[model samples]
Target: MIAFENAAYSYGGGELLSEISLRLAPGSFHFLTGPSGSGKSTFLKLCYGELMPTAGRLTLFDREVRALSRDDIALTRRRIGVVHQDCQFLDHLPLAANVALPLTVAGRAAPAADLSDLLGWVGLGQLADALPPSLSGGERQRAALARAIIMGPDVILADEPTGNLDWDLSLRLLTLLVELNRMGKTILIATHDLNLIRQAKSQLAARVLRISKRRIQLAGADL
Candidate 1:
């Protein structure tokens, strides 16, 4: 779990996020909404240890962020999965290999059966042998998701996951995420899509968090 206690982050000597004190409980789902450049991505970076807060304390898995070493952060990141707005892949490698790259880097074995199952779970079963350049936007997004969860991380953090896809494709991705939440993964998605958040609320207990005026606010029914 990630916790921020009165945490504030600064960039170029200016505060970007302030007073962010929130806990991502196990198996919980949350949506972070904010306008462009409102620190949504910055907050996610802090959560995953890419950036440390300038004031107060931010903890990951129980250890204070500032106290963790570089290797410690790498190990901690293995337990947290992230899906970026722009999916990156090895264009020359097959889809399955791209998804399995993390295991390779971690010096772990990639079981063939498990990799197949994961690709199928993300609806990319048939594309396992396809190159990255041949995929559509939604396909690339789903592939990114598959890569994120290949290690079976405890928490999933998605940044504008459905930004480029059409409404139907977006709903498809949402269903996959909801299914993951049911399977007991802590999920936090940073997005500006209100309709997607509203749709998710109807199916599960998802909290809406709005980042406004340099802080995080727990949104009510007004979302």
Candidate 2:
């Protein structure tokens, strides 16, 4: 589980997040929603240790984030899988290599058969040898999702994952996430798509959290 205890963050004398306290329970699914520049991405960064809190405690799996060294943080990140708004990848590498990157970074080789199977699961099998720069928005998002869970991570954090995709593609990605949650992986998605959230309500027990007024709240039905 990930949590923030009285947490606050500031950048260049401007407060981005303040008194932000929340918990991501294990095996749970949540959607982080808010207007632009509301610190939704910053909160996701804190969850994955990309940014440390400026005023309070940020804990992951019971350990205080500030107490961990850089190496320790990297190791901890292995337990987490993050999908960025703009799916970062090695443009020069083939789709397969990009999706299997976590394994490559860990010095573990992924078998061709397993790699192919993973790609197939995400409907990218035929494009396994294609370069990242060639895939469409949905394909890249799917590839990012495939890469994230390739390591079998315990926690998944995605920021605006479907921001650039069409409705059908967005629904497809959401279905993939819901499937992952059914497999017991905790999932948190930061998005502004209210229609997507409403659609998800019928398929999964997902909670909506809104970052507003320098704090986090369990956004009521207004979402």
lDDT of 1 by residue, 94-213 (tens): 999999988988999889999999999889999999999999999999999998888889999999999999999999999999999999999999999999998999999999899999
lDDT (Cα, tens digit) per residue for candidate 2, span 1-223: 7988899999999989998778899999999998898999999999999999999899988899999999888878889999987998999999999998999988999999999998998899999999999999999999999999999999999999999999999999999999999999999999999999988888888999988887889978744
TM-score of 2: 0.98
Each model's backbone clash number: 0, 0
Q: Give candidate 2 misplaced runs (Cα > 4 Å).
A: none
- The worst-scoring run of ten residues by lDDT in candidate 2 lies at 214-223
After TM-score superposition, the amount by which residue 28's alpha carbon in candidate 2 deviates from its true location, in angstroms, is 0.6
Assess candidate 2 and give its lDDT.
0.92
Say which candidate scores most in lDDT.
1
Q: Which residue pairs of candidate 2 clash?
A: none
